[model samples]
Target: MDDLVINNLSNKGIRTGKQYLEGLRDDRNVWIHGRKVQDVTNENGLKSCAHTLANFIDRQHEPKYINHLTYLDDDGDRCALAFKTPKSKEDIKDRGKSYYEWAKWSNGYFGRTPDYKNASLMSFASASTFLEKGIKGQGGKVMAQNMVNYYNYVRKNDKVLTHTLVNPTYNHQQGYKGKFSEKVALQVIKETDAGIIVNGARLLATLGPLADEIEVFPSTVLKATPDNIPFAFAFALPIATKGLRLICRDSYDLGKSHFDAPLSSRYEEMDAVIIFDNVLVPWERIFMYGEPELCNPAFSATNAVVHMMHQVACLKLAKSEFMVGLMTSIVKASGRDKDLYTKGLIAEVMQMTESIRALLFSAEEQAHEDQFGNYIPLRYPLETSRNLYPRMYPRMVEILQLLGASSLMATPSEADFANEISEDVEKYFQLSNLDSKNRVAMFRLAHDVAISGFGSRQALYERYFFGPPALMASSYYDLYNKDELMERIDSLLSE
Candidate 1:
């Protein structure tokens, strides 16, 4: 049994929050506002989130949450529940419970939790046989076994991961279809006995700064041809690996009081464009490479896409439920709960939340065993959730704006109450049900979700969370049960 889950992790139990933060003090290249960040644990904007994620990790060790967040492995190590492979329908349901719990902890604002990547790794590693079908990569031929080893390593060590899937395109149309530009996109520049040397950049690693490692997987649109061979690969690397750089966008965490910028203060999972300056990906780190045809359907064939979708559906459900709570709270505080229009607005959000809940249940309830002996939640319902959420989230934000009206913007800052105008602040800002201080706190959270720079970025992030909506819808159409439905229509037409 000691050999069941292999690895030599420092702790045989879940690591503490402090230990998690200590991991981020590495030599990883992270830049903000044109200057290199020396330490993510102490930096003004990034440090807040670095610590916030650490807190999330610490929850796994708490007496109250330990059982919910983790389980003891056969090897005697208490591991994260996220790494558990679903062997039966009951296992699928249990995984869903853990996934939803993780999402709800952050109130759905923290988009890239470690469990999200863990789910993908679990699926790929479970179906490690699929990787064996690909052509021998430049790194070597043991890609499938490498995947299983990588999964074990991450699980035993409890590593936080970030991933980038798309290459930045100068010419949009051509670049996205795996026609990566030599100078701009991340493509293999050379191969040696050591490993493959990669260069150029990839976009949208949501937690790049805080992650211990990064999964550089293939873009969904990669084409199968000699021209695209350099771009067809998948591998993981430690964030501290030499020649890897994360160029971040401006941070939304402006070092504000939690009362003033609730979500922004604590949930700033920074997005960055990754630059790989001839980084060496060792043979053991390479999961698949040199087969674009294999790369395109790898996720689907291995059932990784379905598992990732299950995680996402749970996340979106939590997010939508949070909006419903925010809206209902706004109405209760403002004494608008009895108003017909207010009830109507809040009910709409409730419906969207329920819609997400229904889809998640549908996916899980319809779980089936895959060729790899993994019981995966059905992909269709989860796919529907993914396609619908990017559209639903923006409207959910809008519902907040409509309900809050001027309250979302006119809220006083945390500083206003402590300064000389304390009396004035309390006197003027009070609502019918909420005192001035409480009112400000609630509305500031709403502002962070609906009106602030953080809010706008969230809107944009949701809009394209899984890529262009049109493209997603097109693919959904392609995957729909048209043949079965059309057969019934043909029978009716003949009658």
Candidate 2:
């Protein structure tokens, strides 16, 4: 966008849901189902998610939720709670509580809550000085200030952001090693007085169509060689930026009623492949430019990932608890709550849920001051939660399927209850305790969570939320403080 737009951001503490939707009527090119969507707020498969997020935005203005989701800044400006510079342990706990509150809005179904990116931006901005250090002392002071400016700008306007990191992989082997091909990877192809011109495609920008802007950051560790410099920059642009096109996966909503596809109806946040076709990223928007040494450690050095994990930890807790609730409802409706096998399956979910809850609490209780002077939840516990929840979520889904059994498949559509065969459906579909309508409704929700396309995608999303399970495990192993544990083993042997 031009300087006029950047410099004229709205100072409104929080925007209404209608205002948020209206702002999305920009020039963003979003395609789905072999057609370019003209308006996400009105599109059949995309509208529900658009308005769901709008409600999330509007919740910031709600009296009951406002205190949890927002806070007054030093200048007395009411900024999003995610943007608050967390300075103490209490701040960490408060943030965690707020994250849980937001997650409950969708029973943890809406994975890409705006607060997720907001947390990342807040962490980076709070530690803006690290960006000032540039790789090998390259000119980074300006970029540091740019980040500070962008953070304040977004917080003031309450802008919704989606971010892209990974580039499309034509070859699995090369891609796994963080290799980028010029034919497909987004990179700087030319430089102008105004900014750098980027072209090529990136994989997996979630919430791309509905977001106000997109943050295109480094995808992975860069080699820092002259050859790799072009691909090492970080920047943000309005989603409506000219030449930026988003090709989204087929939407899962498909206009299903809330009763028929409860989760899908409310939480099909779009994922897309972003193609930056000679897109110009202004100098003011560049957070990192040709600095692999700095870019590689950007998230870690600034403790941004730790704070990000804190947010994810709470989300996982919400999700896990939601699964437990779903399972309980399933068993109770079938009068199988007293069955030992049924109890065994659900108990496992409860155990897993409690483990996640404990890990989140441990991280918060162990909060410490980082070098950036901001308080961050402890990494190991949060890291463990991040690494473990992916594995846990799928197993929980499996347990749900096991417990749900025939009832999951025996579900009747909401339409069936009003049809001529309504009498047959009412008599046959009734569970031990639940009548036809409520039973069908419960199982439909269960189907949406376990058997439907929406449910399957959720499993896939969690499995790779932090990239490949092997990579996450390897990173976890490397980051573990194994030296102390090894010493303990050594002392035992010596003894």
Candidate 3:
């Protein structure tokens, strides 16, 4: 691991599945079933899927991503992930180009990669640099430490990380005092010099098993009543940390073969219910606690939204582009390309996806500097994507399913294609002069995106990813300068 070569690997994210697993096993806090998991590295249900994602990270080290996605650090002694944010309008547009460069490789499948976590951590790191002298906010120093550790760790080892912010369930009606409160929320039970003891759980720990660490934070605005202090905490724990368990949802890939579940098995983003049983967060790892007002705002004040918006919008747009291309290809192959109805359907999908791409790109190009001096994507455009994509993506997926038609539903199992019934299955289902394997591959992709349990989960993920539309709309309303808009409207009316 010489400086130059290590730097090269860091640029490309060259870590392996074995390295990632070892990292997860390295004193991480993770549990499953009734016992603490000692070997998530090779857990039957989790191993292969985790490894598949690790391979994606490994690819970053390859020549393809080494150039655009990796860059020399200011010191020139280290290499860093290459992404741009705009301090000016021109830079903002350039940032959008950078986002597209990264997104194209994923075709949107790998939206929440370790790079995404890095983006958030970098924002935290940048913001923490402005901490007022002689005053350390609750958990803020811990957050700074975690960010530094993560960046250093990733730079040296090329490992990827993922995190979960929200508790598993939503109980909007229940305040902290309600009996149903703790049942749906994760809260602190005790405090210690080593760290706070958290007892309860978090949800949507996407990629939890694969990540080297799980950074935990509240997903919503926290109110600091005496009872709610524990809920307003932030910390990072190794995935294997004691008393932490990740209860995975029912697997969607089980119903279909790998060929048919193309994205489901590897692209599942395997979200989980993370239960913490008095789990200890070392002082170094804690980011916030006992400050409800600061918790939500602290997260909001950073460049997190800008970074996240670029990642998802770019990835989703790429995916939509692929889908549009795929549907067109399918239509051409099926001899329905000229059909008025089919053309109209595809036109609508194209319009939606392209519009999303345009807005996402505009947001990136329109980025601006925050008070902390890091670049942030423009608020309105990113907010619009955050609002529309959740609704739009499902529809895009639905149209893909519709275009797939009987092909998506009636595909023969891989077993059947390999068995005594192979001839019959092939003759009946294979389409457009393509062989069984190619056609099956297309159908499998469609199943994963549209018909399978993966499809259902994706729909749910989009609907609640940035909170419900109401909450999102409220954020937009709050952040937007209504007074300026009102003044402009008044002037127009006077005219």
Residue-pair clashes, model 1: 0
TM-score of each: 0.96, 0.97, 0.86
For model 3, the stretches where C-alpha displacement exceeds 4 angstroms are 1-14, 25-38, 74-102, 129-159, 168-170, 175-180, 255-257, 432-436, 488-495
Write the residue-wise lDDT of candidate 3 on 1-495 in tens digits: 122121233433345555665656655444444455556656555665666676765565678766555555544532335232234665445445555666665567656666566666666666665321111344355456555554555555555566777665456566332222676578877888766787886767777766766778666655646666667766776666778777776556453446756777666566778888878777656656666666666657765766777667776788789889778877876778989999998998899888987887677666677887667777788778888888788887888877887788876667887899988887876667566677777777777778778777877787776666887888888888789889999999999
| Pairs of colliding residues, candidate 1 | none
Model 2: per-residue lDDT, tens digit, 178-203? 56788998989999999899999987
Q: Write the per-residue lDDT of candidate 1 for residues 173-239, one digit (tens) a residue.
A: 6755657777788899899997899999998899999998899998878767798899999999888
The true-structure Cα RMSD of candidate 3 reads: 4.5
TM-score between candidate 3 and the true structure:
0.86
**Residue 237 C-alpha lDDT in model 1:** 89
Segments in model 1 whose C-alpha atoms lie over 4 Å from true places: 1-13, 136-141, 176-178
